[model samples]
Structure formats: C-alpha cells, structure tokens
Target: MSFSSVPFFITFAENPELAICAEDSIKGARLVLKPFKNNLLALFNVDFVQGLFGLATSGNQLVIGAEDITLGAPLALQLLQPESGKLQRWDIFSAPGNIVSAADSCLAFGYRLRTKPPLQLTELNAPPFPQWIFLPFTTTQRGILESAV
Candidate 1:
C-alpha cells in the first residue's frame, strides 16, 4: 500500500530500514511494521477499534493515536514495542484530532469546547496522567513555538 505524508505513516526510529504504518478505513485501523525497501514483510500488525490517525516514537516506545469512531467517545493512544509484541492503550478523555511527538514526548492534540481556545495539547508520556497544556489564542494569527538548543 502507498503511504501518505500524514502521521499515519512513519519510519521506524530504531531501524530506518523498516517502515511503521497505520492503515485506517471503515473496517477499522491496522498498525503494521514492515520494511519499505525492495520487498514487503510485515513484522507485526495490531488491529484497533477505530482509525489510527497518529504515529510517533517516544524513547523506545511507539505511540499510536486512534480516532473516535463514535461521537463523544474518548480517543485513545496506543503504546507499542513491535519487537516484543508489547502493547498498551490509554484513553484521551477528550476527542483528539491529531498526535505528534516533541521534547521526547508523545502529544495528543485537538480542539476542545467551542467556548475554549481552538487548540488543546496533552502529553501522554506519563500515561493515565496526561498533563494538559493550553495555549492562549488572542488573535487569528498563530503563535510560533521555537525550541532553542
């Protein structure tokens, strides 16, 4: 299957030779670890109840964000170690629209209530105890967050 430029597709951090992908459809989502080179040999695939829309690597663990198939249902973030077949899932409490990794942490982000700001960022590295971060948006212009080394 062809890969998209979205978070659903990513390269395995530990081994660049292998590609990490999540295919989402009406039938549900499937997470796969395979080589993107000459041939295709899937290392492992784990199915989810919803569409897996996010993929990231935090430390030695792989983080997957799943879409809420039903309205008002809490979203999920799955932590996986493909080589050992170890996997764990955590709920997001809120409906998250996307996921990304930064500062060595897996972050689930989306808009919350219409009354609140248009963005909500949550850290999932702690698992079960996600720290919520709110960025104050005053104007229509977006603020740029820069990290200085």
Candidate 2:
C-alpha cells in the first residue's frame, strides 16, 4: 500500500505550528507524524525503532498492524513545513491522554491535528522529500494489511 503527498485532511484556517513531539512512547517504531491546523494529522515514514523516542532518516510508510501497536497519547501538535520538500511534518508532544503504539499507524489509533504547519521544524533533521505513497482506500488494501498478521 502507498499514500500520496496530500494528507487525508488539510488545515487552511490557522496556519498551524509545531507544539511538541513526545516520541518517547512508541515501541517497534514504524511510523512518524505531525499535527497541522485543520484537524489534520500528517503521517511519515520511519526507518527503525531506536528507542522510546529515537529519530531516523530512512524508513518506509507507517503501516498499522505491521507496527503492531496502538497510539497512547493526547498530543499537543502543530504543523511544520520543511525548507525543501513536499512532505509536511507535524510537531507533536504527548498530553495526558497520549497512548503509544507498539506497532500501528498513528492515524489508525485516533487523534486530531491541523495542516498549516509552523516553520520551526525545518531546523530539525527533517530530510527533503518530493513525494510519498498513500495507501489506496479499498478492500484489497484492508485485506492485505490485515493479513500481515
């Protein structure tokens, strides 16, 4: 399965910002994401699961079930735009209700964020990305992903 650069949702009203990233909860990390302005959550590719919250530059699109975990957090997030890339980032932090995923797409767990990201995230180690593959919405996609178990 693949996903497009455009997120499932978009944030146009607030021109969002990156509030925090509580990357210290997930296990077997397979996905990364950021929050935006219009209740949009941006998912990204993660190379590996380093620790509770370790960062990587090489990875694949985050897949649910494959990651094998659930989101465990109430995140305070904002949107971020890198200087040279099409992929957007959501700078998020854990809140009181945050749940970490041992292995699952952040979106599959459940949360709300915006799309209009702030510019502070460019200073981080975010690499350049021209495009991404968003999984198609179909029964086949669901069956294939579900069968991974």
Candidate 3:
C-alpha cells in the first residue's frame, strides 16, 4: 500500500538538537524510500467545554471552528497541505477571538462588535488540487466526493 493509504501523525520538536535529528532522519528515509511521506493527517481536538461549531474546506485545506466557554469569541483553525519538495507535513493556523464561518465558495472571519456593521465573506477561488475542484458545489450537484489517488 502507498503512504497515502496509511494513517500517520507529524510532529515538530522545539529543541534544536531534536529538531535537527528529526529532519535528518526524515530526509534520509525519503532519499531511500523514494516517494515516501507524501501524505499527512490533520487532527483537531474538541475540548469537553468546547463544542464543534463549523467545518469548512478549500482544496486540501480545512478550517474548524469551535465555541469555547472560556473564551469570548469562537476559536478557528486553518489546515493546509504542505509545500512541494518537502515531506508531507501540513500547516496549521489558529485564531482566537475570531468569528469564522463559511458557505459555498466564501469564508468569513474576523472580530465583530455588537451593533457594528457585519463583515463580508472572502471569496475563495478553486485551489490547484483536483480534490477541491468541486468543493464550491453541493454534493448533489457534484456527486459524491471520492478519490482513488
């Protein structure tokens, strides 16, 4: 089976020595393994106090929003595919006190105040990945989203 068919986790070490070791090992394995490490798993946690609010995706990217009781505003996370020429490591962006919502090809995010003007949603164009080509359309319109790659 290919690496894409398997489940794995990616981690980064903060210590300089550990970081260097991890990088070197990954590089060595990639050199010998050919196209290994070409996929990544994106994991999200929903604390007991925080409940899931929304989910949105653009291409290989995903944004998850949650309502945490401790915070005044919702929390959002943006996950993106790793850049080419590197081990398949994903990127994550976290936003606290941000109102995030999504619909169709649009994504709305930012802070808002009571009685203030509403913020506009940002239009997200199709990404380069084929898996996200039909993301803007409904399941009924585009059929089931599946991949055999």
Candidate 4:
C-alpha cells in the first residue's frame, strides 16, 4: 500500500512514535470468505478485503488467494475512524466480504460494521498484531459515500 493508502488509525496520532511505528509495521492480509448479503455485513464488499491481504498467509495474517472470504476463520475486529482529532471505535461483525473500496488516502472504506464497543475507540484495545481485514479510506471519499447512504 502507498503512504496515502494507510488507514487513519495508523495515522493522525498524538504520539508520533506509535503512529510511525504503525505505519512502518503496517501489513496487509487477505481473508477468504463466502458470499453474504443484507444485515450489517452487506455494507462492505467481501471480495475486496481478501484482495488487500497478500493472497496468502504469513504467521498471523492470512493473505487472500481467492475472492471467497468465507474460507477463512472468523476473527474479531475493532473498526477505528478519525473523529474530532481522535479515533472513534466500533466493534463490528466483519468478515472478508465486509470490506469494500478503500480510497487512496486510506482513512475510511465503503463498508459499515456493527460496532461491538458502541463506537468508542478510546475504550477499546486495538491489538497490535491481531488478525485483521483492513480497507483504506479518505476523508473526502467517506463524505461522498456517507451521503449516498
């Protein structure tokens, strides 16, 4: 991924150390999932999430080798977005199919998740190396997408 494609959770940090480390340590992993529709999962495109990963597995991360995300195991995810200079947190039921288009800026994505923590990023513990499926988004792009919704 390009610098612009990095997620806001990895950027815009008060402590540059964590932000810098996250940026450099940032890795992409793919998910293998089956088709799903309606419900909260429908907001994202599962096929894209799998593609973001390397299409294979390396230690903790699984790379997407195919379009079907249903092939992989279900892992927990904490969705974080930049809000009021802080990251807003949500725990959503996300699978590979839950991921959608990520803008070049990597701040947001097209899919929405059912926040497990009720949209509180500060209250959540974002694991450093938890198995994840990420989608990059830009602030401008998110606005447009949200408007459509």
Candidate 5:
C-alpha cells in the first residue's frame, strides 16, 4: 500500500530498515511489511483477523495492536517474529489509541478520557524492543487578557 493510502506505521527509531502498513482489502485487514531503506526486497503481506491500528518494533519483534470499540479494553496483543515465523500473544486490560515503545521494556500510549487502562501499554514488562510513537498535543483552555483604559 502507498503511504497516502491508509494509515501507515514504521519503525523509524528502532529499525529504520523495516516498515509496516495496514492494507484494507476487499476481504479484510492485511499487514504489509518490507524493507524501508532498500527497494530490492519484496513486500511481505499477511492476513490479519483484527484491524491493525498501531505498529511498534523492538529489536526484531514487532508489536501489533488493534482497537475494538465493542470490547472496551484490549484483551491481547500480538508479537510477530518475521524471520523465525513465531508469533507471541499476550493479554491486555485496556485499549490504546496509538502505541509506542518506551524505555525499560515498557510501552507508552494515550487513550481517551473515559477509557480505562488497558494493560495495553501500561505494563511494566513487555516487548523485547520498542519504537517511538508521537502525536501533536492540543490544549482546550483559552484565556483572554482584558485591558483597562
């Protein structure tokens, strides 16, 4: 999938050589992985049951996260080893909007105000390596200074 197509996530900090994108096809959601720095490699696509909403990488392990509005908190997350063909699964309590790798084997992410902490990224021990996810912040509070003549 093209960058302009659907939502795209890459491991820029952890592994600049690899990247991933969520491809929505006529059938269902697909995970597309390939080399970002080199174009000689072919695109690797895998069929995913849940919608891949977020992507983060730690070392060679790729942490895949999904969002389910129907199921309040997230139940689990997937860890895929591309070369080894091994996938690890873990459970989480809450849901996270966007997930990024944090220091000390932690994942940090922001969730809506009403949502509870989904073991999502709150766990202290998770992922072998992590990537950085960044989003712009905004404040709603406004102040106007009044001038006295």
Candidate 6:
C-alpha cells in the first residue's frame, strides 16, 4: 500500500539506520506511510493498533504519541532515544486525544470531551497567562452620590 493512503503521522530522522527501523516498524504491520525522504520516514493512517500519532525530538530524547489498543482510546507519550530505542511511557488521558503541537521543551495535547464542557483549559502543559490588574471604585468616589442623601 502507498504511504499516502495513511491518515497522518510523520517522523523526520537524519540517521539512516533509525529511519530504516521506523519504516520497518510501520510497514511490518502492513500499514501505508509516506515514502521516506532524506533518511526521514513519515507515517500516515495511524489509527491501527499501537498506531503512532505524533513525534518530536527533544535534545537526545524522542517524544512519541501513540494509540494504546490495550487501554482503549488513551493516547500515551513515550520518551526514547532514537539510537538506542530505550523508552519510558507516560499516559496522558483516555478519551481519544492526540498531540496537537510540540516545542523544544513541551508538547500540547487535545482531548475529546464527552459531556457538558466545563470552563477549563484543555491544552496540557500550556504556558501561563500574563497577570492582569483589577481596579475597583467605591460608591463615595462619585461626586453626585457623595452630595446626595
């Protein structure tokens, strides 16, 4: 099957060996992914078992987000070395979530809400908002109110 047929997952690697491993892993399961380019392998159609949804390189570690079929729809992050392939997994949440964005030190995740949405921020590890100042005026501050009964 052609890689273009897959949904959406991409991995950029400069190391040829690492890229090969990624391609093998994706294709071994009879999955379609974008053709590897310049030693980079891009995975698409990531809805299959243990399908990869996101990937980011942070310093020497690679952060990966994948669907864990054993746990249902919970998407988890795995930190690993591309060269060594040693990894540790961290569960983010269960209800069909994916890594929406990533930076040098952080990643953003989005989840599907099932019930009435409460007022809450969904971006995980989001940066703090700037503090704002509030000014309140007393009733006596008004000249007409001070002069009236």
Q: What is the C-alpha RMSD of each candidate to the true structure, in Å?
A: 16.6, 16.3, 18.1, 17.5, 17.0, 23.0
* Model 2 Cα lDDT, one tens digit per residue, 1-149: 22332222211222223212223223323233433222112323322222121121112222222111222333222122122111222212322122223222132123233422211112121232111222212312233223233
Model 1 superposed RMSD (Cα): 16.6
Comparing 1 and 6 on lDDT, the stronger one: 1
Lowest lDDT block of 10, candidate 4: 16-25
Pick the lDDT winner. Answer: 1
How well is each residue in 5-77 modelled by candidate 3, as lDDT tens digits? 1111211111111100011122111100011122112212221122221111122233233222221223233
Model 3 spans with C-alpha error above 4 angstroms: 1-57, 66-71, 80-149
Error of 1 at 95 (Å): 20
What TM-score does each of the candidates earn? 0.25, 0.20, 0.17, 0.16, 0.27, 0.19
lDDT per residue, candidate 4, 1-149, as tens digits?
21122322221122212110110112322211222111112122222222332211122132222111221222222122122111111122332312221211122222113433211111112222122233333332444223234
**Cα lDDT for residue 66, candidate 5:** 30
**Higher-scoring candidate on TM-score, 3 or 5:** 5
Count the clashes in each prediction: 0, 40, 0, 20, 6, 3
Winner on TM-score (2 vs 4): 2
Model 6 TM-score is 0.19
Ranking by lDDT: 1, 5, 6, 2, 4, 3
Q: How does candidate 1 fare on TM-score?
A: 0.25
Off by over 4 Å in 2: 5-15, 19-27, 30-57, 61-149
